[model samples]
Target chain A: MDRLIEAIAATQNPSVVGLDPTEALVPAQVVASFADEIADEVEDAADRPAAQLAVAYFEYNRAIIDAIADIVPAVKPQIAMYEALGPAGVDAYTMTCEYAQSHGLYVIGDIKRGDIGSTAAAYAGHLGGVAFGAGESGPYDPWHEDAVTVNPYLGTDGITPFVEAATAADKDIFALVRTSNPSSSEIQELELAGGCRVYEHVADLVERWGQGTVGQHRYSRVGAVVGATHPEEGRALRARMPHTFFLVPGYGAQGGTARDVAGMFDDAGSGAIVNSSRGIIGAWRKTGAYSETMSAESALDLVADAARNAAIAMRDDLRAVMP
Target chain B: MDRLIEAIAATQNPSVVGLDPTEALVPAQVVASFADEIADEVEDAADRPAAQLAVAYFEYNRAIIDAIADIVPAVKPQIAMYEALGPAGVDAYTMTCEYAQSHGLYVIGDIKRGDIGSTAAAYAGHLGGVAFGAGESGPYDPWHEDAVTVNPYLGTDGITPFVEAATAADKDIFALVRTSNPSSSEIQELELAGGCRVYEHVADLVERWGQGTVGQHRYSRVGAVVGATHPEEGRALRARMPHTFFLVPGYGAQGGTARDVAGMFDDAGSGAIVNSSRGIIGAWRKTGAYSETMSAESALDLVADAARNAAIAMRDDLRAVMP
Candidate 1:
């Protein structure tokens, strides 16, 4: 994994694609490709709606993974999308994580889970590997994602469990310091005493939390999710916590260009993984690059090309400023 | 459901038992009773650790539900306990909800889910129901639950989607105005401008959001979750939002007694559901009623008696004070 980071650095690209498969946003060809197969399965298993959705989700994720694995250092799968489908959704999530891992891409489970005390511990256990009862068989092995996203609204008690579990599992956590959504300012930008903003306080906590999990790559195993849309804030947070990795969302479809995200990285592109979700997986459908006659495989090829191109473009933009 | 409220008023008891099945708290006898069966299942299905744990969880919930269903007006299943087991956990959760419903008890799905905008709508869809292709299946059938808990951090946008969904489905939502956890005061009690606390602001929002869903029982479908530990605050909130239902937690094991929770109810014993999870479910085990030779059925009987006694005692306590 350390070697993979160095490899990514060598390419001078810190772009990580997000696989947020919204049912409505899937390419027409992709939907058409699976329509008949899904119909057959649905007919056969009328009692299992969640299972049918899970199968579709897995196929969609596999397509995106195959498309973007070569260009992206990691693939962030939004757990909410999978969870929305229910247990089968979780099954799809696990399968997608496994698929991404097999393709040599880091899997960041975008689960913005927050709770107090022991409940948080349970969530961490679910994300990282839970010890099997000595000898257990089955494909539902505990997931060991490279990293996970967490919310810190409940303060220290909420985060401690995740930190403990991630440490034991040799994984990482990206705490929400500032989010990309417009409404995020309502809470994150609250003015505190002595002229410090709430997010600044959060940034300091991120630094403190990362102290124990410092990695050899000049970043900590504990990371902060600082949105690319807030470039000035992102730069300040980057400077505030020099040793912490940054998971920067709000790129592409969220109105953040590569140039806006450049300040989030270290001098050597060592500290950030910029995420673009809707921009990548739903790119073909958005851009209309594939016609109706195109095969789903061909459409996926174009989608992958768009994602790879986006990553390359981001890399070039960053290098133009940094170099 | 309205008639149920009327029955509670007639019975003069506002107590609702919460079925939070924490594994560690299960009695030794009950644990031993299921051990062999669970062990065999674990041996057969080693791959699905979640499924194995979920089987135990479902059995435990069934035991608890069967024990207390006759006495309690409702059973609040903490979604986190079920979620900890993964998809199988969700299956267990659905089964538990159905079981509770079948016993003529309301099932409050204690899932503190909150998101913004379209994502919020997606959560509502997932929780309520989604529009699948005609005659085709969708995730979580529309009529699965009577009510669900929601977090209110994102303000109006976060809650409106839930309100719309609940209105359409003829369901209800208990938004987190104040939580029972000790750490809840950290953020929830923050002093805002204009002489109103953050929670008051939340209460006001709850009042506004719930305006449309007022049932014949004179309570709105949207409710506030006010901790029984904060009696004065709960009373104030109740006064401010007269038509809103109040779901009071932090009773019993969390340290707030029946007297402390009494203020959350209206004069007629309406608009409140006081929850005692561990106090009800784990009562017999803690009270040493489960001896060495006590069978699972006997232990369950003891549990039922304890819960029924507690509810009766609570009713007496409330009745003694009411004019």
Candidate 2:
């Protein structure tokens, strides 16, 4: 988180472009480019669709990484999109994260994984590089991301292994506190016995989990995912968890504007990194201005350029409020 | 859940063997069997360990599935174990699940995955055969399982997608209510304003989520993961969510005795399916009685036999109290 914060500070931008390259968002050209390759690898007609899409998603992610690597502080790839493509999809995910980090952007694999006992330890090992054998940090040693998202339903037991492992690796975890969804209020907003909401209770724990890992930026390695859609709650949680960083999702396509997320950051503009997935990567789809004379390869270059411009615009939008 | 219960009835046992094949629990013979094959695939030495272990875990799981297919109704392969091995690990998981189902055992992928909106729907599509497309049920159909575990922290939005998709696919879900870990009480057992525990609140919601999906067994497709370690709470949750089936974990090796899990079931002993992982699959490691006359191949066979017998012993033990 300190490294992440430092990156944000260095770029003077609290934006992490989300790399959720779904089939619909992936350009038609990108899918076509991989069609022959996927068909060659998989003979079955049925298997080719998932394989082709999987390749397209990875190629699209790599393009997006190339587009905004110099501008954004980080990239958050939601694991579900890649997991849907099966093993090959996961391999793409591994490659995408590797690509993003190599481009000097922090990678947050939004896995949202949690469990109990050794199972939790396994997730920690997978995401944070803490193994349990003679090959303590096994063959996937450097493959672990710098940070990952975790669900906190099973309480401290579900979260402690991640924290311990992250602390050991100098990595970080962002617990789902106030998520950016319509029905988030269904359970998260329910008032507790002490009159605080359930999310507030989780917020308290998020702060506690980072007690041992405060970094140079005055932010704990532990962080919270406060939705940009909820400004008042974000403001309240910001005050509550002073040392914790924030990974504020729900920006752009999710109906959250820069003004909506302004309250999530500290006065110095370093406590949070806002995310926008379709808003940036799929920006090419929104604009029907590509010239007919443009080649497929050149069109893809244009798409990456659009993403780069969109990221820059987002950075400026956020800077307007946060800076 | 009705189909799951019916399968259990056919076997006269409510036991689901957990196939969490961590390296420590996987036999040395199994690991060695894959060594040559893994070496053949990768000349690079650094890649050998994970690839070897990944194959070993899958082979171990295939053997276990074959061992106990007829005795047990279902097998829950915790995805984290395979995920720790990277993409190949996930491929092994997909294969293990497919193997279990092919052998006529219900496969409950204990991949505790959850997220907001389309991401959650992707998980449902991967774990169950429902998707967010024109096919909604497409060519990538046979890949899904009978049921999967879900984390309910993100509330209705995160779970609703799974519920909708599972209902469409005629599959089921088991939401984490009270985990068996020692620190589970830190949040799940927290008292709400109405004097109901957080798990109790989740129980009420689980019942509500399953309201439209009651099947022939008078159980909802949406189930609850009530830890066998929590007898009193399980008893309370049982009465509260009468329609909800329970997938009880933490039996045997986790200190959950037959008596401890008895309360999770109804009078007919059909409302819950108890799981035991290490206590069964790794049972051979507990006993060093294999003679020198037994070759490595025969030793692996013995290990499978031990798992089959252990599963049977667990079923008999549960029946003693349940019946």
Candidate 3:
């Protein structure tokens, strides 16, 4: 929604929480409470256990959505975690996407899928809407998502399908420009013939691809994912692709402080969404907020509070600099 | 399995068929035959549609395996097509791998997955079996396959996890050195420092990765996927990665003929497997042998015959060139 841009501008906050929901990381009460309901229906389908697991995942995402709906402007779901569960996992992903959309929260699917030619089109089709040939209805319509992350290793052809589909769906795409991982330097840092690093070339290409999809907010639907860990590079990338939104990861648990991400924001606190996944979900566990006897719900409340406080701090930091 | 390799060497054939069972391409009889069984079972659980679909996929793969077991030494299954269906899709994939193994065929999973660090380990953990975590029987295990395909964009960190797991399982890996897609050159052909192209660097890395994993057949378990279209490059990469096996694609429907891929074979035909997916599975549709007058078994027989004939021709050509 265009209001997403306006929401960022209005609150001066560019923080987006990631709803990863790893089974091992979830609170014990949340697991204990949902286990019975899941067990009753899943007992018959023991062979396909992922279906039952998906139900719990969806519930967990819904709880997170409910808790942070007022604090954050969007939620980014990591597709790999859901995909590892199988189709039932996809079902949960789709449902969570719909739930997030209904709550006026923008959904960004962190699916780094890449392919070439018609296969790329198929992936884009599946992401955008229900594809005709790849079994029943497509999982999670692209229109429902405000944006999706894509891998750029296959180059323009790999990204074109997503560009075309996203343009048609009135959504956005965030290409992997610089990832937060320590090993990202391996290929991304390789010098090309022209002397620019691979990631820089990708950044330039992203800017070009975004040119055709400019929205009413003066930003294009194409965005770049520049890790906040590389603050200087992030600023350079932001300067290079001024019209493109930046989905900056590596915040919080990834060792990026809020102050480190300040350069990604525009003068009005626009064009960026800083993401924090583990730092938010596992905050209570790390802070010892829950006692051995405390309920999971109480611990979750503290976890949600920690996330809210973190977002507020980030928002305040950006405002102090940009205001 | 080593003896099997010796047999293939003696025969001078490196042609392997890929079983990519897309639903749209299935024969009408097979679809109609399985329709009632699927419908009846789908009544109880709507979420288990993939399970029913997987049954059809498993049957189709079984039929294809039965048809080509005598013609080829190995089979590659594109995991994406199966995964597009969901967990039942995964079920179909695992079942097909087991079936191919039973038929004395090496199974290569064409899942071009790559990630960084622990995430890469998670992927390898799923593909290559993991031992029990502490006291648990391990979170999930597929018992590992004979081999799996990987992407090298994330560099050595991405490959290290795979190497570790595959080494532990005594399995193999085929890294994406160069793909067959027309636009692959966009990133893959970029010139790096020291006058070497990106693909050459990747081939060099593959060579290094294979250093510790050489099998008794004079070829390493680590392999590189060199497109058959690039004959000169294929020969050069083969020379560069002396011990690494070359998994050549772009044969048949991709337009590189049997002659174009001959350079990939070692002196003894010890290190390459050319793949043909649509050329085999969709042969009946292409040759107009699946007309209304033709029986399902007869049409299937024709499809298998074409595949066997193609393989034989390829085999004869390779044998003719050997010293």
Candidate 4:
């Protein structure tokens, strides 16, 4: 959490780009360009389409990372988009994480993974890289994530392992406290017998989960994911969980505005970092300059430029609301 | 759900083998045997250890699948075990699923994935294979799973996509209701203002989520994951979620007994299927026949024989308690 806060301070930006690439987000020409190469390289014809799209996703993510690495403090790669492509897509996801980290940007992996105690220990490997055997020099960290989002439905034991791993690796984890989705209310907003919502209880638990692991930045390694969609709730939660930093999502394309997320930050405007996935990464779609007739390189150039501009706009939007 | 029910009836065994292989579970010689082969195959020296273990896991799973295919109706491969090894491990997970399906056994992928609407749709591609492009012959079904487990924390929108995908693919899904872990009660057992527990509310949602997708077996495409550790709750839930099926975990190694899970079944003995992971897959360790000097082939043979014996013993144990 301290590292993320410092990176945000260095960039003077409280926004992070979401590198959630899909076939629609990547340029068609780029995917087409890889077809011949993929055909020759891949032995199975059935695996070609997914393999080609996976490569295109990596290229698209790289372009965006290169374009916004300096302006943004972090990049959140949604694992669902990659997992949709299967094992090959998973390869692209790891590659994207490695690329983002190499560019001096904090990589917040939006993998909301949760399970039982032992299994959660296994999933915590995203933070503590796999020590395959007795090992060589050290563990091979295939998924180079600085922080990852976790689901809190399974309770304390499920999250404790992640907290231990994050503490050990000097990384951070954001538990899903209040999500940005509409149906989130169905479960998260349910009233408990104690006159508090489920999400509120979860917020308290998240704060407790981060107790011993608070960094010098006055925040905990266990952050809370408070979506930008609920402004009033975000403001209320800001007062409730003092030690838990927030990873605010659902901005831009998801209809979350700067005013909505304004109170999510602290008095110093450092308690939360807003994220815009489709808003930033798919900015080229909104740009009228993108043409189907353009070559792969030109299309990618457009994607990079549009993403940079969009990321800057988001930063400024959040800054205007900041104290 | 109909497919699973019929398969369970075919073997007269309401038990599923859980293929969750960990470093401690696999025989030393089996992993050691893959060292030289992986060294020659994997270009990155750092990746050899994990890659080697990944191959050994697939081989180990293949042996277990072969031994138990005739006796067990299904195999639930916990994805977290493979994910611990990174992308190489994920490959093994898919390969394991494909092999089990080829053996005429239902493959229940124990991936408790849930997200927001759009992201859930992307994750639903686990059931609905990725349609990479227009010209693709058919979607490359990379994840060869007949059914998958989903987390219901995100509520309705997070679950709809999986239900739709499972319906379209003629597959099924089991949503986590009351998990098997000790700390699961922290959230699941919280008393609501409406005089019911949080898990009961989720149970109703699971029942409703599967409404329109009911099959010939009087069960819906959606199933509930009720742990074998809670018999009273399981029995009550069986009565509550009538149309919903059950995929019970924590049967053997997780301190659950056949007597504890007996009530989870319906009067006809068809509502629930119990799972045992370590008690079956890692059974070779308890067998005194296993020696460190044994060959990889001999170790796998031991693993297979021990697994078959344990699985058969488990089936008989469960049958003695069944209706």
Candidate with top DockQ is 4
**Model 4: per-residue Cα lDDT over A1-323, one tens digit each:** 99999999999999989888888889899999998999999998878888999999999999999999989999999999999988999999999999999999999999999999999999998885555643555556778899999999999999999998898888999999999999999899999999999999999999999999989999999999998999999999999999999999999888999999999999988999999999998989988998999999999999999999999999999899999
Write candidate 3's Cα lDDT for B261-307 as tens digits.
Answer: 77777776567778888777776676755676666566556766666
In model 2, pairs of residues that clash are: none
Query: lDDT by residue for model 4 over B257-303, one digit each (tens)?
Result: 99999999999988999999999999999999999999999999999
Question: Model 2, which residues run further than 4 Å from truth?
Answer: A132-139, A290-295, B128-138, B290-295
TM-score of 1: 0.86
The predictions' CA RMSDs to the true structure, in order, are 3.9, 2.2, 4.1, 1.2
How does candidate 3 fare on TM-score?
Answer: 0.86
Best by lDDT: 4
lDDT of 1 by residue, A218-322 (tens): 777678888888999998888888878888888888889877887887777567878887776766665657787887778667767676666566656656755
Clashes of each: 3, 0, 2, 0
Residue range B1-323, candidate 2, lDDT tens digits:
77798899899989999999887777676687777788889775666777788888877888788899988999999988877777667878888888888899988989898899778987777654533222433536434478989988888888988888787777899999999999899788888998988888888988999998999999998999999899999998999998999999999998999999988889877799999999999988767766555665776787798998899899999999984
Q: List the candidates' TM-scores in order.
A: 0.86, 0.96, 0.86, 0.99
In TM-score terms, candidate 4 sits at 0.99
lDDT of 3 at A304: 68
lDDT of 3 at B266: 76
